[model samples]
Target: MIKGAITGLGKMGISHAAILGAHPEVEMVAVCDASSLVLNAFNKFSSVKTYTDFEKMVESEKPEFVVIATPTKYHYPMVKYALERGVHVFCEKPFTLTASQGEELTELANQKGLVNQVGFHNHFIGTFRELKRLLSQNVLGEVFHFSGESYGPVVTKEKGGTWRSNPEEGGGCLYDYASHVINLIQEIIGRPEKIDGALLKSFYSKGVEDAVYSLLRLDNGLSGTLLVNWSDETYRKMSTSLTVQGKNGKIICDATEVKIYLKKAVPSEKLEKGWTIKYITDLALPVGFYLRGEEYSAQIDYFVDCISNGRKSEYNTFEQAAYTDKVIEMIVNHSKTN
Candidate 1:
C-alpha cells in the first residue's frame, strides 16, 4: 500500500483524505493544518497523526506520498518541502500562483524522479475520456471553435473577508474556478498561441475579479472562448462545448454528451428539405450525469496506481501546470490593462 499524508484539512484536503483512506491501495498516515480547529475536527473521526506543521508530520510519519491541498499561495513552499524530502506529491489545481514557480517545481520533481500529480478531476471523468477517444478517431474533425463556462457564487466567509477575496492569495473566479476550464482546454486542444482576456469585479469584494472572459487563438488555427464568473445567479453550472466542422461531418460534444452529424445526402424523395433543424437528443447530458466526487475518487486511484505500479499518470504534470500559470498571468495582465 502507498502510505500517504494530507496537509490542509479544509474542504479539498478533507475530501482528498477521505478518498485516499477509502482506497484499498492507500493508507492514510497523517493529516495536518495550521488551524487547530480544523485539525481537531479532522482528528475526531480519523486516527491519523494530526499536526499544525506539515514538515513535522513528514519527518515523523515518513509517508511515501503527500497531498498538498493548501491555499494557492502556500502551494509552492509546501510542494518544495515535500519534494526535497523525496516524497511523491499530489497537489491541488492552480498548482502555484505563477508560471515560474510551477516550472521550477516541475524541474525539481523531474530531477528527483518523483511522482507528481495535480488535481484536475475533470480529466479523469468517463465522459471526458470518451471525448478524447472520439477526438483521436477524428469524430470531432477540423475543430473550429470551442467555448466553456463555469459560473457560481462566491464561496467566502459570511463576514465578507477571506483569503478567497484577496488577489495576493490567488483569489478570483478566473484563477480559482477557470483553472479547470483552462486545464481541460489544454487537454483537448493543446496550449494557445496568444490569449486576450477581460475581467470584471461585480458583486464581490473590491480588487478581486469575480468574473472573467477570455479569447484564445491556438496554434492549430482554432479559436476558443471561456466565460467564468462567481456572480452568476444561475445554479452552479459548468459546461464545455466544442463545435468542429469537417468535410465529412460536424461533431459536437456539449457537457457530458457527444453527437456526430453526417453530411451524407438524403433520398431524392425527401430532397425538398431546406435546412431542417434536428435537435440531437444524443448530445444531451442526462440529469445528475457528472458526479464530482466520482472524478475525485478516480484521480486518487490513478495517483496511487502511478506510485505503486511505476505507471505514467495522466494527471497534470509540472510542465502543464506551468503552462496553465502562464495563461493565467496573461489573463490577469490583460484584465488589468483592458
Candidate 2:
C-alpha cells in the first residue's frame, strides 16, 4: 500500500482524509491540523497519528505522499517542503498566492521527479471529461466563443470575517471561486493569453469581492466571458458550467450532465442533429469508494495511481495550475485599470 499523510483538517482536508483512508491502495499514516477539536476527534476514532505541526508530522511519518489542503498563503512553503523531502504531493487549489510561487514549486517538483497534482476536481468530472473528448475530436467544428461561470451561496450576507474574507489569504470570488473556471478554460479550451476587462464587485463582504466578471482572449485567439459570483442565493451550493459555441454545434456542460447541439448528424457518437443530453451516471467510471462526489475520489485515485505506478500526469499539474494563477493575476491587474 502507498503510505499517505494529510495536513489541514478543514472541510476539504477532512474529505480527503476519509477518501484516502478508504482507498484500497492507500494506508493513511498521519494527519495534522491546528485545531485541537479536530485532532481530538481523530485521536479518539482513528489509529492514524495526529499533529499540530506539519513539519513534525511529515518528518516523523515519512509518508510517501502527502495531501496539503491548507489556505492558499500556506501552500508555497508546505508544497516546497514536501517536494524537497522527495514526497509526492496533492494540494488543494487555487495553487498559491502568486504565480511565481507556483512556478518555483513546479520547477522543484519537476527536478525531484515527484508526482504532483492540484485538486481541480472538475477535470475528473465525467461530463467535463466528455466535453473535452468531444472538443478534441472537433465535434464542435470551428469553435467561435465560450463562457465559463459559477455561482454559490457562500457569502450571501457576510458579517464576520474569516481567512476567506482576506485577499492575501486567497479569499474573494476571483481566487476562491473564479479560479476553477479559469483553470478549466485554460486546460480544456485554451489558455487565456490576455484579460481584456475585469470587474471585482463586493456586496456584503468587507475586504474581498463576492463576484468576478471578466473578458478573456485565449492563445488561439478565442474570446470568452467569465462570470462568477459567490453571493448568489439562487444556488444552494456551488454551480459551475461551461458553454462553447461553434459553427457546427454548441455544448453546455456542468458537473451533472452535458447537453449537446449538432447542426448535422454525428452518427459515430450516436448523437443526432438538434439536442442530446448525457448524464453523469452514463459517463462516470465506477470507483472503489464514494464520497461527496465521484470526482473527488477519482482525482485522489489518479494521484495515488500516478505515484504508485511512477507515471507523470498531464492533468492538473502544477505547471498548468501556475498558468491559471497567472490568469488570476492578469484579471486582478486589469480590474485595477478598469
> Per-model C-alpha lDDT, please?
0.74, 0.94
After superposing candidate 2 on the true structure, give the runs of residues whose Cα lies further than 4 Å from its correct spot: none
RMSD each, Å: 5.0, 0.8
lDDT of 2 by residue, 73-185 (tens): 89999999999999999999999999999999999999999999999999999999999999998888899999999999998885968898998899888988899999999
lDDT of 1: 0.74
Off by more than 4 A, model 1: 155-159, 237-255, 262-292
lDDT of 1 by residue, 195-298 (tens): 75555554556667777788877667777787777666564555545544555465555455555565643343232222323232433223222234357777
Give residue 220's error in model 2 in angstroms. 0.8
Instruction: For candidate 2, give the lDDT.
Output: 0.94
Give all TM-scores, in the order shown: 0.86, 0.99
**Best of the candidates, TM-score:** 2
